[model samples]
Target: MPKQKGNLWTTMWISYLETCLNNYLYSGIWFQQFQKIIIPHSQSSLMTKRLVAYFLINKVLEETIRGDYCKNKNIQEQADPTLIPKTIITLNQVEASKFSYIVGWMLFKLIKRDYLMNSHPKFSVICILLRSLCTEKVEYDVLETKLQTTIIISRSEFVQFMYRLESLVIELFEKHNELGSNILRYVENSFLTNLHLNQTFIQILKSSNGENNSELENEDCKFIYERCVLIYMKSRQKTWRSVNNYIPKKGTASL
Candidate 1:
């Protein structure tokens, strides 16, 4: 991507041509089979996954445009947008579900590689990415499979991640015009109450107050601690009271 193209990537971490999503053609699909007999299956390589995603998104876009055209069409008007009959692309429900999984795997690769944070992806892009990251909130989130590994963050790194998360929450709400439900569910169900992240915050604050880590004395860290306190109070949206000594100081919830 050129410097002039896509604001040279809003975040500037690392990027591929498609992150900006300008009509840049990354590749051309060359499958010999016609659309009627294709079976949608997951793929491991990013390139193949991109093609699967392209297929899925193209279906969605086609349906959406056709629907719009239909609603606006007159009773006697032609049904097709091009006024010529073409093979209609149809997908089974189970097959359609694989699309998100394919795209999500690629998005996770982007996040794990720090592709998104460094580049300023558009809000629509952010919206899609956020949906994939936040899991559905239940009374207790299901335990992960042993096959999936957990990420271990240092105290400083944890603080930075939380700060970035808070910044994103504000950005989506203020600039994007609406708060995302997935992020809201994450904050309410997982983030505010997570023992690991909250515990990390407590240590960072304690280290700052103890004057042992001068690097953690910045105002952003201070605000993150305070904001965590505030959000903790709002966690689970219950009528709650605070416990003074163990909260901001101990990294335990006051409510």
Candidate 2:
């Protein structure tokens, strides 16, 4: 087995992208330019290439946020304990904005495209990226029937963000499109890996299997219900309910 196949391929991919963009890789703005170029070109390119762009963006985010953590032992030693990866995040405000802008746009597109009916590995990684934003350590707090671990993000931030995410699931599930098994696998693994600390999420995953109905709507509802439970778990009051009472309101939510 060759040891360097992955890294060597990545090196070549970066070189390939640099040539196409006619620009050397810089830090923040380079991702913006990459996204801009891809949007129009994507319609005519293979879907697999568009998915590769997701992985590329995620890798770029890791590089910008972790800085030299992988290469420098000193940075790893100095990382914040509260951070799961235990590395310094973002080189500066400019770097942080770049991360946010790209990630937020991807979520918006995923909502629009329904991932073109395919699961993306980087979609789960996107959830992990949001976890990086919490500045404080989590604690065990009791809510109603059981003790709960506060999420990696703060109560206010987590609730607000998940509420918006719930809306995304609602929008997508409402489409009644037949979701591919790959997408379901990614969604399940995302909750199991990144959100296993929350017992409710685990329960939702377990319950989904006992479901007998094979209808597409029922399957979609499983994930939609999971998001709703997640929002409930993150709520400060430990319960959540909302009505769409929109009269003059129509806009998108951003991270």
Candidate 3:
């Protein structure tokens, strides 16, 4: 049994080396000096299991954007703005969920750095990108906490963030009306499918001690809800027809 365990460890070591060689070979780096490590004792079961694990991790990476941003904690308050270029590329390659998280974290770091440096324009283009990345059903604890912190860093900074965010919403709506509608529909479907959105909203309202800002409640809220219900009806025609006829039109709520 001890010998068998040793062999397994040996295989793991060999696997890591192979992974490195695979990368180097593809890059054509150090090819001439590289000595090939032969798999003398092939262990199919072990290799297959590890391969499966790799695939799962890779899927998460692709779905979660390789976790590059979170993995590299070297991001400093005074880091180069040039990092945005790499971040953009990484975001484009990540899966939607992973990408959203990465964008959120990056925005948090930017806000933190900006606060430390006393920058007026903390809510820059990158900050806008962060909010845009937030899905209608976003639930990142880190993001929510940081968002509250950033907003409270100073009254003026909070106001600026809200103002900039409002501008961003308007700009996005104007720039991509059709696309925005579709995206909203998608978000609504997710809410309905999960059976948690309405409940969550209720909780939020309750937590506000019923003093929920009536100011933020506007025609847009009604429009958003109606749009979601309409989209829901379309997809669930047969299942929801009876209730669909009872749904209120735009600018009204039924509940």
Candidate 4:
């Protein structure tokens, strides 16, 4: 890794970012700065350096929102339980935008861990929203189901967002079900690790699977059907009607 030719703060910000993200420390000094930090020049970029600092802090809390409780004891002691990680990240609005990718990537990496995936909603929503906003086109797999890609926010929090995610999901799912379902279904399945709690979502899925046939229009629906089948098979003994009946002979569904 080549050294970055920058002042104290610029170097400090880059070092702290690398430390927090656990990535290569000194590689791609030019491109990483351009892509990740939005820093272009090296001479007395104090404003840019401070922005980087803000980005790193927000990225840390945002990516590991739920885990922050266990990880940042000082932050935990200082914060109110009701305050979500999303709120904290957006508090410094300007800096947060600059570090969006870092925050998003952190959340992505965290949700891949099952224990972390099942841990808390704070982290879950961060993952879901980030993916939804950032990843426009991607493939769906068991990894999506296993990971905590969606927040599965409580009804109470849902009303307060000043914007409803369900409406957003419906709109996005309607337009881009493949990507939407890829993100939404993960939220549906893993948001509440306890399947019993998400009875409403399960029913919505059950109804979709119960009636739909091989002529599926939305890719999200297909992904959701596949995920529901797996979740049902894993947690409950019964098989979903969507899998056993609707799926064609070419495909197979199992736990």
The reply for model 1, stretches above 4 Å from the true place, is 1-183, 211-255
lDDT of 3 by residue, 24-91 (tens): 54664332222223223445565564455456545655556434433332221222211111111211
When 2 and 4 are scored with lDDT, the better candidate is 2
Superposed Cα deviation of residue 208, candidate 4 (Å): 2.5
In candidate 2, residue 204 scores what lDDT? 35
Backbone clashes for every candidate come to 6, 0, 1, 1
Best by TM-score: 2
User: Which parts of model 4 are misplaced by more than 4 Å?
Assistant: 1-69, 72-190, 194-197, 209-255
- For candidate 1, give the lDDT: 0.36
RMSD of each: 23.9, 21.8, 22.2, 22.0
Please list the C-alpha lDDT of all candidates, in the order they appear.
0.36, 0.37, 0.34, 0.35
lDDT of 2 by residue, 30-53 (tens): 545666886645654545654666
Tens-place lDDT per residue, model 4, 1-255, is: 326533334435545765755443334343355545554455646667656655675566567643432443332233221222222212256643433433334333443543534464343333353233233334445655654333322222212221222222223223222222123233333322423223333344333333333333334333333333344223321212222222111222222
The number of clashing residue pairs in model 3 is 1
Q: How much lDDT does candidate 3 score?
A: 0.34
Clashing pairs in 3: 64-98
Among residues 3 or more apart in sequence or in different chains, the pairs in candidate 4 whose N, CA or C atoms overlap within 3 Å are 125-151
